[model samples]
Target chain A: MHPAPSVIVFTVLSGLGFGLLSFLGLGLPQVTGWEAFFYFALAFALAVGGLVASTFHLGNPQRALKAFTQWKTSWLSREAWLSSLALVAMGLYAFAAVFLDISAGLLGWLGAALSVATVVATSMIYAQLMTVPRWNHWLTPLHLLTLSLAGGAILAQQSAVALALLVVAGIVQILHWVLGDRRFEERGHTIESATGLGDIGAARLFEPPHTGTNYLLKEMVHVVGRKHAQKLRVIAFVFMIVLPIAVLILLPQGIVSAALAILCYLIGTFASRWLFFAEAEHVVGLYYGARSAQAVAG
Target chain B: MTQLPETSEKKLGLVIDLDTCVGCHACVTACKGWNTENYGAPLSDMDAYGSNPSGTFLNRVHSYEVEPRAGGCSQTVHFPKSCLHCDDAPCVTVCPTGASYKRQEDGIVLVEEDACIGCGLCAWACPYGARELDLAAGVMKKCTLCVDRIYNENLPEEDRIPACVRTCPAGARHFGDLGDPSSEVSMLVAERGGFDLMPEQGTQPTNKYLPPRPKDQLPDMDVLSPALEPVAGEPKGFLKWLDKALEAI
Candidate 1:
């Protein structure tokens, strides 16, 4: 819940990158030779760059190779495996299209599926956390997937498809916020339940464990002002969804429009992703006398 | 390797008495002292003696004021919290590096410092906030339940327990196998009605907490009214003599 800069960048950039990769794998633009090379280069830069950015937050980036071993139970591990597989598959497909001038039909489809799966796996890293009530919802994955596809469609120059997906993404975002706000109360965690003192009486924090802050307080207990969050939500919606849709409808389809659309979408997604972490209410904060997510949302 | 065993042979955990804890934080200090020296990584502090000091600690004590709903005096409950070492520990399964694992033998959840990638996903998965990321070491640190001391043959037999349990001044901390029905801890839990923290989370924590006893129950009385009541119809011995002398004057 720290709204860590590394994480925000990682999720937004990677989501967009993978979205574009999925489209390219499906031969959405159907370009060959140098034109195909340029698109592939852009996709790889975003995808690989985002992956590298993710490691920046790790305390021990040197040991990150060990992260691939626990894919059986860990979503983070699954994400590592999935992203690697997606990259390799997409790499082969890109090589065939750009250099060999071949479609590599089956490989392209496989790469596309893996690319989307990688994004889902990334989303699961947050969605699987029951500790954060705002993120532990079905809508979390749905929201991310919709945004990724919408961004992908724009990059692929599919204006009609992009417009529809953008509308859907906007709906999912609203639904995510509306339902996520109520999740903490529905989960029924409170200071009393947190301390097992509900049967006796109402409990309030009389004294903290220490005079200064500790790791838990720093990592899990983030406070975002409601007014500020609301403003950001509006900004995200207007730029990420409304503007992209408006541009595709009004401006002539060209490289200039696509660039403007991509830029606006990235800015909006970055803001939304920041809110994603900042607004998440981890149940651990209940022990420190933080109000539940429902109360904070109010 | 991150997958937990179906069942651990023993559920080793602590039973904390809320009634007896004086909020002294002695256990907290003792835990830090013992763990920093003995564990995989020394708990590091940044700006320890300077402004804005912060450090990694395995255990912490929090105090809360509980106002009974039945309308009695409020009570302060000193809560000493650390790793619960849950039977269904989310931390272990969430570890991407296979560093966080629960021992099948003793049910002690531990972090293998060597294997740790310091990704911190385990810390996020834990609802209790038990695991902490060591800033200097870039690895996770948690309550090992003094695994080093408890099993070390060098220590005295009486010292074969968690540092917090051994050092608790009020004897409020109890460490034992909670899995066995006949264990002292299980019996104590049965008698005192010990309860788990955040049962809704379904972590199924091995640790238990004994709720504080009820306070401030007494019958109403008027001490001043009894004192003001007339002892005699006229007066007592000293007052009678004074009244008679006054009448003569």
Candidate 2:
């Protein structure tokens, strides 16, 4: 809910970085020379920077070490574990490709698989939250994966592949938006269910727990105006998908055009991520008498 | 460590009566007063005595108006909400560090403050809004069910209950082991047809709420129809002559 800036940056940047690493791992079109070094540097910067940025959101960042110990049950721990593996493997693969001037096939494959797993683990962190019905669906992980692939393709300068994946990502984005809006109501929880008053009568919130905002209202029950959400969705779609596609199709394959597309895609993805958090309606909101599920939808 | 025990020896939880709660908020204040100092960290207030005064509270009472569909009179219900300490608690399982856990002995869910990294995931996992993040202490806090007092050997036996339960003016709150079939709370639940909150969420909450009993039926309007028969003769009384005398004057 709060859509903290650090988390947004972490998700988007890490997705792009891992996506790029996934492409390089496959050795698609035989990357070599200074190009390989450039790709490796960009991937490291995005992935490590994003991971480090995530720590800023923690209340006690120093105690985060214990987070790795609970991998048996916590997806957050799993993400940390997988990201470590991915980064370590990717580092070795980069050392071989850039310094030794040799293609490490096994290391590349391991790096690629772990990179993808890391993103999946990241998605699972949110997707596993049954309290937030919007993020509880399989569509959440699907959306995250598609975005990673699309962003990765763009960064890797794979025009044909990028265009194809971008279209797919765009379609998933629209579908997720359409579906996520109706998710809360589909769960069939009402004030009656929330308070266990279904057997007695129609229950409605007469008085809130407090006169002022509490942590639940501030964190879990964030309200975004419908009109503002719609406007943002359109802007997100235009910049994230439509403009990137337009730039790729209209301009020649070069550094300038690629950078432009990447910039627009990042901006668009950020807006879309913001909506992902903003539009999400936690089931706890039923106690607060939030408007109908359809109204909360983007 | 987050994995719940197969069976806890005791399921200590609160059973609140919807029929008797008066919405006085005594339990809320009582909880705040006791817990602010009992737990390791104080439940800090950000703007106390200021324009926007607010503080972290483990228990909060929410009042609702229930309009009966069967033409019964609308009733005001005061619902006090806190941690359910479910058999399968999502909050405990979602903790990245083994900080949030349910005790095996008493089934009381608690956060190990020393180990808690304060990621706030447990707060998100709770659908009941029972968990509150203490911004000042940089850790999550919640209803400990007066863990400090309930098992404190120093306290008087009668005063060992949770502060909320002890302070309830209407005696609407009951604290006992719901796991024991012979317990007073379990018998009360069986007799009153008590129900769990958000059963659909499948938390298997230890907390139970006894619904209000049906109201008594009122007399039909037709039963009083004969009383409205014309008081044909307001005559004969001394007051009748008084009206005529006033008119003549």
- Distance from true location, Cα of B100 in model 2, Å: 0.7
**Local distance difference test, per candidate?**
0.91, 0.88
Worst 10 residues of 2 chain B by lDDT: B230-239
lDDT tens string, model 1, A157-276? Answer: 889888999999999999998899899999998999899999998998888888898888888887855458989999999999989988898999988888889889998999899889
Cα lDDT tens digits for candidate 2, A1-298: 6777888999999999999898888775356668789989998999989999898877778899889888888999899999999999989888888888888888889989999999999999899998888898888888998899888888888889999999999998998999888887898777899998878778888888899988888788888554588889999999999999999999998888889999999999999998888888778887877754446442
Q: How many backbone clashes does candidate 2 have?
A: 0
> Recovered native contacts in candidate 1, as a fraction?
0.93
Worst 10 residues of 1 chain A by lDDT: A289-298
In candidate 1 chain B, where is summed lDDT lowest over 10 consecutive residues? B215-224
Which residue pairs collide, candidate 2?
Answer: none
Off by over 4 Å in 1: A224-226, A292-298, B230-239, B245-249
Interface RMSD of each: 0.7, 0.9
Model 2 Cα displacement at A296 (Å)? 12
